[model samples]
Target: MARGKEYGYLLDGLNSERAEMIKRALRAIPEIKSISIRPSQGTIQLIATKDPETQVKIACEVAGCVFRLKLGRGQLA
Candidate 1:
């Protein structure tokens, strides 16, 4: 996918509480530069210095949920 392109994923079965927990966990990763919630897809987009694989691993470990990461440059960045 092109940089800055919006990616989508299904975060089904996760309620607001769980989503917040996941967001907290993801934010805990120092390498994660930033994060934004894509409510439409129920997915969280993370802007990180670390690679997608590493970010996903940390997210899974902390949130106890499977996550997929897509790399894209932010238009404003």
Candidate 2:
């Protein structure tokens, strides 16, 4: 299996303040491989070995906003 997977999330309610909260929430989850947040554009990029849906879900939940999937790239062999 691939060691990592990358996904992008477009969140509705993400700002500088809530971005920190989401960061903390993602950090607490071991399944998350990495996270990059763009507070200006309200975009979150994540690398995770687990389910992408779950990762996006948690991010939206923690940010208290609706999530729209912006991008998903499959692992290259």
Error of 2 at 71 (Å): 1.9
TM-scores for all predictions: 0.54, 0.75
Q: What lDDT would each prediction earn against the true structure? A: 0.55, 0.75
TM-score quality measure for candidate 1: 0.54
In the order shown, the candidates' Cα RMSDs to the true structure are 6.2, 3.9
Instruction: Point out the worst 10-residue segment of candidate 1 by lDDT.
Output: 1-10
lDDT of 2 by residue, 1-77 (tens): 55777777777877888888888878877777888888788788877887666756776786787776666454211
**Candidate 2, 12: how far from true, in Å?**
0.8
**Cα lDDT, model 1, residue 22:** 67
